[model samples]
Target: MSKEVSEEAEHAPPKDYTDPPPAPLLDVGELRLWSFYRALIAEFVATLLFLYVTIATVIGYKVQSQNDPCGGVGYLGIAWSFGGMIFILVYCTAGISGGHINPAVTFGLFLARKVSLLRALTYMVAQCLGAICGVGIVKGIMKHPYNSLGGGVNEVASGYSKGTALGAEIIGTFILVYTVFSATDPKRKARDSHVPVLAPLPIGFAVFMVHLATIPITGTGINPARSLGPAVIYNNRKAWDDQWIFWVGPFLGALAAAAYHQYILRAAAIKALGSFRSNTRN
Candidate 1:
């Protein structure tokens, strides 16, 4: 009886899911496909629209709030602008390019082997260019206010130490990237699909909540493209001084989130080790 029970346990079907084989590190053949270029276009346009709407809202709010303490859209509104734009863009472009408007998200997926290095780098470049163009359009439209107001630049706000700002960015970006991993997890998709439209909702809300928490610290730059665009267009020395934090913090956060989800939550390392041992014995 004991032998039979042990054999039954050993032969039990697998209970957990693992992602399929990882994407190639580089797939040069992707360049030959029209769909690949189409995806790039989708990412570019999504990011452009995201920056345009969000930055314009920020500049507008600053202008309004100065005149009347309650006149402008408050920080809450700014958060909504960022979060809502993300939700909208993600929903629109999910099928086309996975709607990665932020480089940090792309980086996280790359670390998890969800995207190739080539695609990741190209997406980041597209996002940055789109961001720059978006902000440029806003500046052209509202030159005086764009120059006078903050230009939606992210910096260490008054009374916040550099360390505090950096920490906020890192943690904030971790929340975002972690949410991305969770939302896109294959296991979850196999279970219920998250309704497609609803899949991006939580990711957007994550952005909203992080912005609310970190707005005062560093204007909440979980997305480097968002921060870099305004800084470049505005050309503010203060913004430039703190640029390192935005890039470093988000990338570090992406790394941490990917490691956490893939190694711990998914037990990828354990699975690989088990496979290696079984193969050696075989």
Candidate 2:
């Protein structure tokens, strides 16, 4: 009976991946529709809330640490603020817009053919605008304290070279996007759907872990929008000077992650090669 059960399980088909065909470079068919606008609005609001909460946490942490270096929430708390917000926001907006609060994540998915050019472009614009508004609110409410803390803008620390900071952002973002892909992979999701929190949890944890590693070097700009929002608002020479690293690093990292996840780790290329070899042998 045990042998029969093992055989049956082995022959059971793997969970299906429900991916549609790659969308065209431009999908103008839905450009005039309400659904598209609703999705964009969702992205906007989610990103806005995300930036507001996370940046506020950073500013608050700085204020406390200034008063008493050891009394404040410290690095761990800051990491949690960013990660926890991501987990919550993703859970709330996943159904509406795939919960891509980060431009790097959206770009990665676009490269992997998960979103169309039109959707990707619009999502990016909305996210940036949302980030700007979110930080703008923080600045408005905490005017005196806001500029003092650089408004939580990401910048390279004194000792770290530009190369080191850029590399850190790249690897950090790669971990994030890779986790997003793995967590949301259809095969994994189909099997794990009963545990609804499973998908967003790892993604949040990735953000937390990356922050822990890179905070000392570059204040951890794994999200370009997160970096840009505050940098633009702060309008400082240093923040703007170091801004290119945040965008370039995250984008390159995201592209690497999309390619790795879709082609290698997920075995699409390997499976194709294996099938080809088998047919030739037969």
Candidate 3:
């Protein structure tokens, strides 16, 4: 029996992946579904927790460093806080809402036809609201320092020009969204089916690496929701002044990543435009 099973496995044909039709442009029926609302809730809660922890860390770091230059968790710790939260939250929410937690990510996936425009827009709204609430909680709890400190708002650092800051955000978000696509690709999934945890680790690492590289430039606004949250709460002129860079840069980055992943790396354009309509998403 073992010999027969081995022979059967050896002779089995390689599985082929066929493309599923793209997600509907507007899945109105989804609004009535409990699962859809559940997913929205998951995204909202995850983002809320993400912003709360990260912004609090930023505020705490600022307060500490003011008194003692070497004190507090420092920039490294702040990056860890953001990345670690992403890893944990993505792991927790991947099943429910794809664990976007970032509007730029949702936009990229939408461009790749992995998500519908409606779902992407709603997810972005929920994420933004969650972020605002998260930062509000931080302000309410740590009123004095939160106000005095910068409220963790992102902005172009003094030495950098707006163009440079925009460039940084664009590249940083491209790295992040590119990692998301690669990590979640069906090909990777099939090849490494035994190691499911691999997805969030690289995603988290990408965030950490981007933060390390660009934190000094634009305070790293790779996620529009992240930049929006603090800017809205802090209501600072400097933060607001540089706000366009966060949105425009991340969005452009996401678009570039999507086009590159779909048209070039995955050869999606060739497949669909050619004889085959191969699967792009699992």
Candidate 4:
């Protein structure tokens, strides 16, 4: 009987409802290694490239649209530029750094127990620095045009209230961070997670769709670093005035998403299922 029980246990399927091991709040072990540095470098370069391409596209489009609204790529094209760049950059750097080019995404993942505090903080710093450098490069090359076109700084559009603008940013970031959590959930089947083409598309699409919805309201600042880069470089009072919305809205949205996905959607379902199983057994 003992041998039979042992064999049966060995053949049993893995538990269906097990939560992943929670990452420590501060993972000191990760900080002592060269791999950590490599990951940070990847994040820095990816964010830099992302900001450079997107900011230049914004400036270029504005310059081309000079007098005619129909002259340049317009709103839809600008949205695509931001989305497409994120897809490319995420794909390129996902393996090296988890491809968190946005600090909002990092914060969401940190709250969801996907990464440690140290990693989240370091990634945010790298991303912000990268963004600054990226926008600086654009300004350096196209100094006059860049500044003339507002340096691609995000601003609340005319006729919109600050409350409405903040709400737009909050919802936009919620969509983005929610998609990131769903895409990168480790509990996803191995085949799905390992599919080289799967994860980045949804995240990129989220950015694209959110931009389409919120661009006119708050110029679509779902990433605080993206907003800060242009604002810092432009150094305008208007940009500075509404800067808190970009940071506060995205962070709030990210936190809400983490709570919703991790606790309400994931953990609650597991608990309900476990209770159902217990009642059935009883």
Question: In terms of TM-score, which candidate is strongest?
Answer: 1
Q: lDDT of each model, Cα atoms only?
A: 0.90, 0.89, 0.89, 0.88
User: lDDT per residue, candidate 1, 110-195, as tens digits?
Assistant: 99999899999999999999999999999999999999998989999999899988899999999999999988887877767546
Q: Would you list the rank order by lDDT, best first?
A: 1, 3, 2, 4
lDDT of 4 by residue, 1-282 (tens): 434444444565775444677789999999789989999999999989989999999999988899887888988998999999999988898888899899999999898777899999999999999999999999999999998888888889999999999999888999999998888776664536456757889889999999999989988999999999999898999999999999999999999998889877667445545556556656
Q: Model 3, stretches more than 4 Å misplaced?
A: 1-20, 194-196, 276-282
- Which residue pairs of candidate 3 clash? none
User: Candidate 3: what lDDT?
Assistant: 0.89
Error of 4 at 106 (Å): 0.5
Off by over 4 Å in 1: 1-12, 15-18, 192-197
The TM-score that candidate 3 achieves is: 0.91
Task: State model 1's lDDT.
Answer: 0.90
Please state every model's RMSD to the true fold in angstroms.
Answer: 3.3, 5.1, 6.8, 5.6
lDDT of residue 149 for candidate 1:
90
Itemize residue pairs with steric clashes in candidate 2. Answer: none
Which segments of model 2 are wrong by more than 4 Å?
A: 1-17, 192-197, 270-282
Provide the global lDDT of candidate 4 against the true structure. Answer: 0.88
Q: What lDDT tens digits, residue by residue, belong to model 2 across residues 1-282?
A: 434444544565775667567777788986888988988999999988988998888888888888788967889999998999899888888888899999999999999888889999899999999999999999998888998877899999999999999999999999999999999888777667777566888999999999999999999999988998998888999999999999999999999999999898876665556556556656
